[model samples]
Target: MPSLKDLRKRINSVKKTRQITSAMRMVAAAKLRRSQSDIIAARPYAIKTNEVLVSLVTRTNPDMHPLLRVREPKRGVVVVIASDRGLCGSFNQNLFRKAETFIKQNRDRYEDIQMVLIGKRAGDYFKRKNVAKRAVYTIGTPSYELASEICDDLIKGYVNAEYDELTIIFNEFRSALTQVMHVDRVLPVEPMEAEDDMMNVEYLYEPSEDILLEALLPLSLKVFMYRALLESAASEHGARMTAMESASKNAGEVIGKLEIKYNRARQSAITTELMEVVGGAEALKG
Candidate 1:
């Protein structure tokens, strides 16, 4: 039980909290809308580019391109995309857990396993882990230049035999309330099964197939990376918006309960004071 003054203070504190949460929810919603639009626009181009790139890779000699060359699974690296900030409920945690499980399960498969973490949260979460970090990046906004830089680094590492395989782990934005975890094998480009009609149909290239592939493969990879970043950003915003909305609602409920308590306490105090005044007056008259 608290006095009227204490109750009033608590109600004020909760009201302030509710205001903050409400503001955060709105801000997240605005960001989410922008992120959603970006991802939606990028998806079609990314998918089609990947399809064309895969078709070309399968028909050509894998040894012709270093990126297409698959090597022994001795060493591997996982690129994890997460948010820099907290308050996105379970967004970072889920990714961290998935990455942990992946590393643990494949520990016996790969002789060496390292991490390429994007976002501050990932750096913080994996800092104490036994795994080694190849690179850490802050995820500010998804940009083509950033994607190209990261793709080039990974390509360089793979060509230099620093790592045998590359996998990217990220959250795919599905809806405001739902996100799908995606684990994509980004390097050592696997050949997709070609359709029967397409395999038989030979098309002429103005440039040599090798030249076309040389340009397309890296671009495809960069597009994929960019799309992943967008998806992650959108998912983070969605998660935060959902989380903040829930917090605001919970705060409102708590305020309601506290107000009831405050009212009861104030009423009790008033009733006691009134009773004392009446009793004193009656005694004076007597």
Candidate 2:
């Protein structure tokens, strides 16, 4: 049993912590809203681009574009997205778990396996291990510039035959309280095995199909990388907001329990003093 003073101090400390967590929850909510909107806005573009790519790939040969060539993976790489900062519950933990599982499950497929980590948490985790080949911790926010640069490097690696396959792993934003983890193959793009009548749908090209593919295929990959980053950003914010809210609620519960304990302890002290006074008076009277 804690003393009344100790209980009171605990209560106050918990209240202060509750305040901080509540504030963090609000900030995370704001950031989440902004990120969510951005991802939502990007969805239409992603859909249309996919439609175009599907049609184009059906009409053109896979050899027409460097990104479309599929090969057996000899050296495989995973691009993992986590967060710069924590307090987001198991967001990063779950992501890292998925990444680790991927590596373990696919270990037999590749002679060489490596990780390309984005954000501080991912870098920190992999740095202690022998698996990380490269890391960039400066991904403070999701941006087109960052996405473009990442895609460029990945494409360069693929073109140089540095890696036969690449995969990107990240969290996909579903709702404020929910997120889905995704493992997407970054290269070489999976060619359409079956072209439907949808692919039969054609249009006039300003330039030759080869020229269009040369430009569009890379653009398609960049867009994909950008979309994944956006999804990850939104998911991170949502997870943080949820975690903060839960922390605040837990703090409230602790404060409530502490207040009850404080009241009980104070009452016990007062009762003890009253008994002592009564006994002293009785003794004096006797």
Candidate 3:
């Protein structure tokens, strides 16, 4: 049992911590709302882009463009996206684990496996392991410019034949309390099964199929990257918000428990003092 003074001090400290957690919860909630909206707006654009790409690929020959060329992947790259900060429960850890598992499983197939980490947390983790080929850091918040930069590097790598295949690993936003880790191939674009269904549709290209494809392919890739970054950002915000809300609730519970302890300790002290006073008066009467 702690002394009344010690209990009071502990109660005060818990109250301070509870205040901080509650504030963080509110802040995270606000951010999550904005992020969720952005993600909702971007989803349709991404889906339409993919549908167009599928239609174009099905109608065109595979040899028409270099991006559509698929060959045995001798070398590969994995781009991992994670948050720079922690305290979001298992958001970063889940992505990292998925990336690591992929590398380990595919080690035998690829002669070289390179990593491009998007966030400080993922970069640091890969760097400590001495496994990353190139890592970009300090992408404060995921934005179009940052995604464009990453897309440029990935395009260069694919064009230069640095890697035959490129994959991206990140968390996809589902809801405030849910995020699903996903690993998707980003380069040497795979032909979709639905492509065949779109092949019969009549369409006209502005210049020609070849020229339009040349321009559209790269832009599509950039858009895809941007969409991924946005999704990941939204997911991160949601995870943080959910985690902080839970923390705030837990903190409230802890404060309640501490307050009860403090009251009990103070009561015990008062009872002890009263007993001493009563006994002393009786002895005086005797």
Candidate 4:
């Protein structure tokens, strides 16, 4: 058991911590709201882009566009999206574990493998690993410019035959409490088979299929990268908010317990003082 002074000090410390956690929770909540809206708005455009790409791929030859050309599994690149800051619970840990598992499992499939890490956390995690990092970027706000820059590099590497496969790993925003991890292939865009009814119908293209594919394939890939960033940003904010809320609750519990302990200690001290005074009075009277 601690003295009254010690317990009181501990309670005060916990109260201060509770205040900080509560503030962090509110900040995270605000950020999450903005990020959630961004991701929600981006989903529709990303989905429509993929739909259009599928339709275009079905109509055009796979070899017509560099993005559509499939090659043997020789070299590969894995793009892992995490976050720059910590205090987001297991948001980055889960992603790192998934990326590690993927690399371990696919070791024999490719002759060479490299990483493209989008976040300081990811870079720090993989720094001591044996894997090579092709590029490492610190992620901030999700923007088309950043996405385009990353997509261009990926496309360049793919077009140059430096890598045969490219895959992206990210957390998809579902709700404030839920996030779904995804591993999606971004390079060598797979062609989907057209339905029989759609196959029979002929549509005219303003430009040739080849020209249309060239314009759409890269744009589609950039859109995908941008959407992934948005999802990750929202997921990070959600995780942080949840973690801070839990921390605040735990701090409150600790403060409550400490206060109880302090009250008991103070009462004990008072009782001991009262007993001493009563004994002294009895002696004097006697």
Clashes of 4: 0
lDDT of 2 by residue, 1-286 (tens): 8777778888888999999999999999999999978888888988888888777777788786778777778999899988899899999999999999999999999988878898889888887776847546457888888888887888888888888998999898899789999999868888775445554655899787788878877888888888888888889989999999999999999988888888888899999999999999999999
| Native-referenced Cα lDDT, model 4 | 0.89
Off by over 4 Å in 1: 196-206
Tens-digit lDDT track of model 3 for 12-126: 8877887887787778778888887887787787788777776766667757777878868999999888887777888998888899899999999998899888877887777
Q: Model 3 TM-score?
A: 0.91
Q: Locate the minimum summed-lDDT window of 10 residues in model 3.
A: 191-200
RMSD of candidates 1 onward, in order: 1.9, 1.9, 2.1, 2.1
| lDDT by residue (tens digit), candidate 4, 136-195 | 998888887999999899999999999999999999988878899999987888777765
Q: With candidate 3 superimposed using the best TM-score fit, by how many Å does residue 161's alpha carbon deviate from the native?
A: 0.6
In the predicted model 2, the residue pairs found to clash are none
What would the per-residue lDDT of candidate 1 be over residues 32-125, giving only the tens digit for each residue? 9999888778888887886677677777776798887888899999999998899999999999999999999899999999899999999999
Every candidate's lDDT: 0.89, 0.86, 0.81, 0.89
Candidate 3: list runs displaced more than 4 Å: 193-204
The C-alpha TM-scores of every prediction are 0.93, 0.93, 0.91, 0.92
Error of 3 at 142 (Å): 1.7
Off by over 4 Å in 2: 193-204
Where does candidate 1 clash, by residue pair?
none
